[model samples]
Target: MTTKRREACPNLEANLEACNCSYEPCGRKGLCCQCVAYHRRAGQLPACFFTEAAEQTYDRSFDRFIQTWS
Candidate 1:
């Protein structure tokens, strides 16, 4: 079987420098699939989950994500 290639988000790729996701454990810094999977497994979104300032704080916790959205 052949392995499927992952797709990268052009928009995100162009804006990675501005992205604030601080969870370094993520393998997909600009890749949407890998990022989504990583967050899903951890029950959280990537650094892009919060504003630039908030993301800079490096708090990728589920509660923080909810607090931001709320």
Candidate 2:
């Protein structure tokens, strides 16, 4: 299992500016490290990997990621 670091994200503003995640209540919205690690542990990709349209589906599976990009 991967460990989560509780350090504050230094580039939060930049990350938020670039993030397209639409999940309103998401705790990992601007925390890229936590978001990536959480998604990786679930065997899926994060919202950033998908298009705006695809991201609305909330399907973060690896297969979905491939289909979205391919």
Candidate 3:
């Protein structure tokens, strides 16, 4: 298995401004790529995929995403 390296996000500051993720202590907060990969591996969507209200639920499941839109 290949390990992926976590590098400093060049857009971290800007990304943080737009990030709506309600998870207070998430290490992947402003690292969009890592956040996406992590959630994808778990068969879920990232907080950024959800609306602000939905993101607060912290239910990153695909089903929840569909529910939010439906």
**Top lDDT prediction, candidate number:** 2
Superposed Cα deviation of residue 40, candidate 1 (Å): 0.9
TM-score of each: 0.58, 0.86, 0.85
- What C-alpha lDDT do the candidate models reach, one value each? 0.67, 0.86, 0.84
Models ranked on lDDT: 2, 3, 1
Relative to the true structure, candidate 2 has a C-alpha RMSD (angstroms) of: 5.4
Segments of candidate 3 deviating more than 4 angstroms: 1-7
lDDT of 3 at 68: 94
**Candidate 3 structure quality by residue, lDDT tens digits, 1-70:** 1122223766777888898898988888878988999999999999988999999988999999999999
Ten consecutive residues with minimal summed lDDT in candidate 2?
A: 1-10
The 10-residue segment of model 1 with minimum total lDDT is 1-10
Flag regions of model 1 displaced more than 4 Å. Answer: 1-26
| CA displacement after TM-score superposition, residue 54 of candidate 3 (Å) | 1.3
Q: What are the runs in model 2 whose C-alpha is more than 4 Å off?
A: 1-7
